[model samples]
Target: MANKTAPDSPPGSAGGTPTRRRSERSRRAILDASLALVGEVGYDKLTIEGIASRAGVGKQTIYRWWPSKAAVLLDAFTADVDEYSAQGLPDTGDLAADLKLVLRATADEFNDPAFQAPYRALAVAGANDAELSRAFVDRLLEPGIRVYVDRLRAAQEAGEVAADVDTRVAAEMLLSPFSQRWLMRTGELTYDYVDTLVDLVLRGLRPGS
Candidate 1:
């Protein structure tokens, strides 16, 4: 007769449900530890060992799930990215005000060193790797941009935006300047700068303005 394995014996002890649950727990631990370490030591100084230590998992566990530290960081970044995307753009029935509010929040996010550290690392990783770049756009960038597009469509319906304005292009105009400024270090990103961008876009895109 075979002996029964304990529910908590190990990840694959029971060969089914317990193993899946354990895998999920380990994945979450790895991501949380990676994010925390990035905040503490910056991404340049982060290592798989450090994450393994913080997560209380074997290095093999992390390696099995993620091929590299950048991959782990990208996975960790997704949670926060999803959170902001899900929140979407503000809809207070005022296009300018709502845009201003969204841009201000974007500026705040860019200005945060904690958020910027992982972001910069991820950006570099994505730039160097084609597959990773596509994943980043699909998982993070496009979702956020879609939110802006949705907001613009709503504004169009409310007569706040012109009927002929291309919402996709219009949305890009609203977001791309800040992205370029941050990525290229072309200029200081401030609420004031974002406000100016929003004003210009609204003026151009608004009906009969």
Candidate 2:
């Protein structure tokens, strides 16, 4: 199998000893390997040894950085998520356009097969595992989601959304449609679906407007 790193990635990412860029590079390679492999092989089959092998790093290296395969995967997810911040909705001052962009980006992430494996495995793991569920909620779910909360708040402040809008609830109204569909396979996630979600969300938030 080819051992080449994915093209266009920066020379690793942040969060390691400042002196050694190599360590960061190694970590990112392992992470990319984990995500790619997990997508190809279910989470149940993921292994620290496998990640180390695929990443072209020592098994001891992975062990040095993380306690387990799960820990490695967690770091991988954390390290990669900043890349998604770019997808955070831009405020073009058009609430409808802004909301549509945000939801579409969200749906796009949900549709990634590579992202889905770990997400699905984690969701299933979460049900019987409170600590995992809480960690998943706090670490994985909340940060990116609060961007929607903030955007809705901006809309309410600008009177684009009703004064009575509950930002938390309103954010959910925008988010849950995609989550429900993706998790339940209830419907396909597409640009058209997200646009419809945006419409429904706006219709609910606009008070007699």
Candidate 3:
């Protein structure tokens, strides 16, 4: 009788399940190593070899999944951000107060010592690398912005925000100043500063204003 086997199965295995499980483990290890290494050595010194060594995988393994260390770092950062943003923005039925809470929390994260180096490295590198910049905006920044947009839309439905207000633009107006101040170092990022921004933005967006 002829031997029976599946064409796609790995040699000496029943199926590809073990291979897929191993691949997922390697992927998680690579992402974690990238995040840890970026924090330890900063982005300038981070390399595929370093990530491969820390991850206990071949450099080819990382190359197979990501083109460069920047791509790896971006993926790692996106994973981290996604974990935090899984809950979306807060909506407490008071638009101004909720905005203040969220913005102040964001300010705190931006000012965090542990968060500064890796974030600044990505931001600075993205400034010069157009492809990475676009990826950063598309994969990381825009999703977070959409959360803010969702909260604003909720507010609009509740009569806290004007029905005519464009949530996307309004979200940007609410967030852009805080981001600029943090990224440019042009102004202090403080809770009071974010509160003022929230106030000014809400003043313009309020119904019948």
Instruction: Say which candidate scores most in lDDT.
Output: 3
Q: Lowest-scoring 10 consecutive residues by lDDT in candidate 1?
A: 1-10
lDDT of 3 by residue, 1-209 (tens): 12132122212212357756676677788888987888778777899999999999888778777878987888888876676578887777988888898888888889997777778888877888899899999989998898899999999999988999999999999888788888889999898899888999999998999
lDDT winner, 1 or 2: 1
Evaluate model 3: give its lDDT: 0.82
Candidate 2 per-residue lDDT, tens place, 125-187, comes to: 667778767877776678667778888888788878898888898888878777889999999
User: For model 1, what is the error of residue 60's alpha carbon versus the real structure, in angstroms, after optimal superposition?
Assistant: 4.3
Model 3: pairs clashing at backbone N, Cα or C within 3 Å: none
Please identify which of the two predictions, 1 or 3, would achieve the higher lDDT against the true structure: 3
Instruction: Let me know the TM-score candidate 1 reaches against the reference structure.
Output: 0.79
RMSD of each: 5.4, 5.7, 5.9
Best candidate, TM-score-wise?
2
TM-score of 2: 0.83
The lDDT per prediction is: 0.81, 0.75, 0.82
Name the lDDT value of residue 134 in candidate 2. 82
Q: Report the C-alpha lDDT of model 1 over 1-209, residue by residue, as the tens digit.
A: 12133232223212357656667688778888998787777667889999999999888777766788877887787777777787877899988888888788878989898777777777876778898789889988888789999999999999989999999999899888889999988998898898889898889987886
What local lDDT does model 1 show for residue 124?
75
Off by over 4 Å in 1: 1-28, 36-47, 60-68
Better of 2 and 3 by TM-score: 2
